[model samples]
Target: MLPLKGLSVFDFSTLLPGPLASLILAEAGADVVKIERPSSGDEMRTYHPRVGENSANFVMLNRGKRSLCADLKQPEVVERVRALLERADVLIEQFRPGVMDRLGLGFEAIHAINPRLVYCSISGWGQTGPKASVAGHDLNYLAETGILGLSAGADGAPVLPPVLAADIAGGAFPAVMNIMFALRERDRTGKGTRLDISMADNLFTFHYWSIGSGTSGGGWPKPGAELVTGGSPRYHVYKTADSRYLAAAPVEERFWQRFCQIIGLPQELRDPEVDKKAAIAEVQRRIAERTAAYWCDVFAGQDVCCSIVTTLEEAMDDPHVIARGLFDHRVKSGSVALPALPVPVAPVFRSVAEVRAAPGLGDSNQELLGTI
Candidate 1:
């Protein structure tokens, strides 16, 4: 048993953000029951290219959790959820602004049934913003909040992040932290608190460094021109001789100097007379002169903060990751690879007694209704 083994959570959310939040709780040993729709269920279940019945996205994000599919529109279903909430210590939801309210499962409504429930609402723009009612994805939220604008490519279109910055960082992480703190606070006051984790708000906060840099007179990412935003030679991805990529970030002066020395670049490489483009071009040229593997070998045990760009396949088989057993395979609905939770303690068991593989449209009717 882990720290949260007995703490029950009612997770009424789906897709990337809310499910991930609840999954974290589940991983830590909370008895989290994911409340999916009676119809369609969680969209992420079939979002990706499926290997048999499971989607890699769903299985990875959702391990060690039970699914309680409910037609939340039904009065009996809503009351059933209320019953769970009455006993649960936490409730997490990620519906757009008014969906919960329409379902008569708003925080105010449910909190009346169980004032001790730590309620958390995860949304794109939060529950009360001007854009609160508007629909948005991770990219749109970050774009509106200025994070997507910064550190974007020098090309025309902005690049979407590989990971869900807003989802994991903004939604899941904060929900876990806040729920934990609230649970702790309830130890003293014996009452729970509500949380509004807006994806847009979190994105804005994620851009704090750039925001501070600009508004505070440090200068923001001037489009491929800022610290870690491609202005400095120390930070950026370069195309190597074999057409593979190498990412280098020697941020500090010493590290930058060391990187230059390793690559045989002169101090004159920083001269403005050569122009930023020409200087970067020279660096690119030098990097391209050698294969990525060659540079990878050269930068070993160096303070250069340099790394060969590992494709997803390469990352899974990386020596360091393999040494730590990070991506050990497990048979879920089928054989699957999952990243182990990066924590101090090790896991005893990796499976859960879960039924209804990601809920195939109203799969939990009998279970949920029987509970009622």
Candidate 2:
């Protein structure tokens, strides 16, 4: 049986963070029911680049889950939801701090109904901080937490992240991990607990090395100037003749020696005591003399830890990725079917089904609310 086969989750979250947490639970066999608003439902359903019926974003993040639409302002609807919470194993929400309390569905209220429910609240800040009620997004959270200031572009400005690290890494992954911890605690104490997951607060963990460096009197890291950031010649990106980028990270002494040999660098330039700027410039010049494909062929059999940066499409179709079965599971809507979003859950814990459909808005309202 799946690990969470009998667990029940009521997810009152929209967009990226909370929904994604619940999605991981559902992937591990929890019966997750999304509680959305009445007509418009979650804003993600209307996002750009539509697929079968809803936005592809919604379909990918919410596959294999049921949806129940209810107007929380209605007393009858609130009562029905409370009845369902009495038997739920997990509850996830992402509204501003007091919004759930105003709706009478907060952690304390739900804990009273079912003491074993793992109640999780995800927000940009946190539940009781000075900025708890303030509005923010992924970029704002990264900027506020000093993560965005560390990576600077050639223009000397902090480069915007390509993905939602705060939402997925900070908010969603931490919520899921803590919910599992809370569940284990409930098994020991026979009582559940509240989880306050702050996206901005959790971002500090990603910079542990930088934090230790500053605290240990080794000087704080400057923008684009750390060993793993763009400061070292052994761990930096170089441009090839066709303008494609090669991500090179032969940091170890052995790999660095091999990389120098493969690139045919001069003996003097191979020494670390030589001017780093000169070494980096020479490497860039040599790489620029050849195309990315030429470098790919040259480094194919070697283990110098380098790769030509591939596009998203190319990565998706890579033979090694396909062999690993990352995209084997499919999400379906009407006749349109695409690979499901691969969560970090291992294959042995996920469902055996190959295909599952994302629910339409309010698809479970009658089936779930009528009984409740």
Candidate 3:
């Protein structure tokens, strides 16, 4: 009895944001029917370095989801989806704004069929904004929200982050939260709702530190000038002498004091404005003198919130992440390890395995056609 177990989601999203959102739902027990194209499939199949038929990007997202291939432009296929929409609790679409309306499968069309259906539109800029139709990715969204400018590095330019922050925050996080809220609302009103979440617009929340830098619009320099964006030594990455990086965060006075004490720095270096840079530089120099393994031992069992800059392989064994069970590997066969999810049963379906792999273009035609 996992949460969202019985609920069926018609997922028309591809690439990242929408699919990931639906994946979370699927992980939570939503019967997610990934409605991909009959030919090329979701653009994600062709994305990244391939890994044994599964795209690294696709597998990371599409686990526990069912595949249903149908071309919306074709009347027969559209009819099939329309039939499915009648029984669907949610419709997750990541296409541009007008594409749905063009397909005659917009919110109005679906609401007419199932008034209780939660319709979610995930996009880079949002559905109604002036920039909604613009083609953009995580970088574009981050740049638009002024968050990117804050992450300046030693080169004095914006640093490229490793995650799809905008897509995750604005698109996925909001999408799931919004749909959940709508589910609650549906329970009360017995009707559906429309959700429009924009990745570019939501970047403001991710840049809280940047936004907190200054109140006056003219006081800020887009993003790179902000407190959280490596502007202060308190929240920056430092390279050790051995080329290992130590990610430090001593934003508070108490933590800074402890950090200074651990590294044996002068008291005057405590003030963020007057001595922050020097303090960080000193820590960098001191930490550099030792290897990451040595500092890991040094910082172990400490509350300084200081950590080594670990790579993907190193991150898997990170203590906190391990404790939380961040990566759930259930089924393992020789060379393949598929992610297993045992989502708790609530009001939703818990065991949703409708679409397994990216299908062979209309692979489920017989199964879906039988339903119609």
Give the number of the best model, judged by TM-score. Answer: 2
For candidate 3, give the lDDT of residue 318: 78
What ranking emerges by lDDT with the best candidate at the front? 2, 3, 1
Deviation in Å, model 3, residue 201 alpha carbon: 1.5
Residues 1-372 of candidate 2 have per-residue lDDT tens digits of 999999999999999999999999999999999999988899999997788778989999998999999899998889999999999999999999999999999988999989999999999999997999999999999998888899889899999999999999999999999999999999999999999999999999999999999999999998867787787889999999999999999999999999999999998998888888888999999999999999999999899999999999999999999999999999987688889999999999998789999989999999998886
What TM-score does each of the candidates earn? Answer: 0.89, 0.98, 0.89
Give each prediction's root-mean-square deviation over alpha carbons: 3.2, 0.9, 3.3
TM-score of 3: 0.89
The candidate 1 region of ten consecutive residues with least summed lDDT is 350-359
lDDT per residue, candidate 1, 1-372, as tens digits? 577888889888888778777776776678778787654667787777774466767766666667777778788768777776777899999988888889988888888888888999998888896888998887787777777766467574567778778877877777778888999999899888889988777766766677787798876566577756787676778999899989998877778778888888767885544466666887898999999989999999997899998888888788888896655534254444444333222455333333213333444456655765
Candidate 2, 115: how far from true, in Å? Answer: 0.7
Give the poorly placed runs of model 3, Cα more than 4 Å off: 216-218, 221-226, 330-335, 339-363
Q: Candidate 3 at 177: error in angstroms?
A: 0.4
lDDT of predicted model 1: 0.75
Q: What is candidate 3's CA lDDT for residue 235?
A: 80
Over all chains combined, what TM-score does candidate 2 have? 0.98
Model 2, residue pairs in steric clash: none
